[model samples]
Target: MTETLDPEDAKIITLARSVRARNGSTEGAAVRDETGRTYAASGVDLPSLQLTAVQVAVAMAVTSGAKALEATALVTEADGPAEQDLSVMEDLHNGTLLLAGPDGSLKGRHV
Candidate 1:
């Protein structure tokens, strides 16, 4: 269920929503690195490439030298974060994962 998000968590959620709207994508995600940096991305689907929004955000964090995540926010119409999305995030570190509706309302949270 929805919890009161601290400013940091709210920031990522906002970023995720902005990306989803701007990209016209079904899913958009943002993650905060342990270093306080944030990365945002939308789902990618091409003939030769496919990645969930969370995956792309995680990749961006890693590519930027993020060793662990502080938190993650995903905004979409889906029921919840996908299984693969959970796996990839756990691979880095155990952090809060927030799932929000397209309207920016929190649907669920996993820790």
Candidate 2:
């Protein structure tokens, strides 16, 4: 079974091991560790805006997971700088894997 990390614990993990994107599949795959971040882009050819929307939507889906349905997921990547979709569906599908430190320093880049 895949060991899914707790939303908070995922933040503590250091770096990304690898990522695999599936063509035409809603679920993408990613693994992280102390090495570095890795990602596999999605197959859906979506525009930057649409891709952003999908990423936001997928993050919402991940955070909701079978518990809270009405609450919105943390859209940190979108909250900062320019919101370019950038084939981030896989990352969002993986959910929030890292967080900002106590002083607001980002521990890891989401995508």
Candidate 3:
């Protein structure tokens, strides 16, 4: 059965998908802060710097002055989130993580 998502979560899924498509990255991630501000980013691949979508998204939130995160969403084909992704979320706040397929279908969730 398909999982139902809150409207805010659905927005993040859409943002992640757009970032992934725009960058042609393997994965995309979006995070919402306690104040309801959202940040979105795609995986970063560089000769000197390599970061997952979730990592980048979290960093963006932190750099933008987000004290805590309310939720996170990733749009990708991966079966689950990576260890680093979970670490980032833990650093911010213990919140829900929604995983979605490339087609925007809810795949899994972690809290």
Candidate 1 structure quality by residue, lDDT tens digits, 4-107: 98999999999999999999999999999999999999999999999999999999999999999989999999898899999998999859998999888899
What is the C-alpha lDDT profile of model 3 across 1-111, one tens digit per residue?
387889999999999999999999999999999999999999889999999999999999999999899999999988999999999899987689999998899998899
lDDT of 2: 0.31
Estimate candidate 3's alpha-carbon lDDT, on a 0 to 1 scale. 0.92
lDDT of 2 by residue, 18-49 (tens): 11112433322222222223322222345653
Relative to the true structure, how large is the alpha-carbon lDDT of every model? 0.94, 0.31, 0.92
Native-to-model Cα distance after best TM-score fit, residue 49 in candidate 3, in Å: 0.5
Where is the poorest 10-residue window by lDDT in model 1? 1-10
TM-score of each: 0.96, 0.23, 0.97
Using lDDT, rank the candidates from best to worst: 1, 3, 2
What TM value does model 3 have? 0.97
Model 2 segments beyond 4 Å from truth? 1-8, 11-17, 20-49, 53-97, 100-111
Q: Best to worst by TM-score, what's the order?
A: 3, 1, 2
Task: Tell me the lDDT of model 3 at 66.
Answer: 94
Best model number under lDDT: 1
Superposed on all Cα atoms, model 2 deviates from the true structure by an RMSD in Å of: 11.8
Mark the regions of model 1 whose C-alpha exceeds 4 Å error after superposition: none
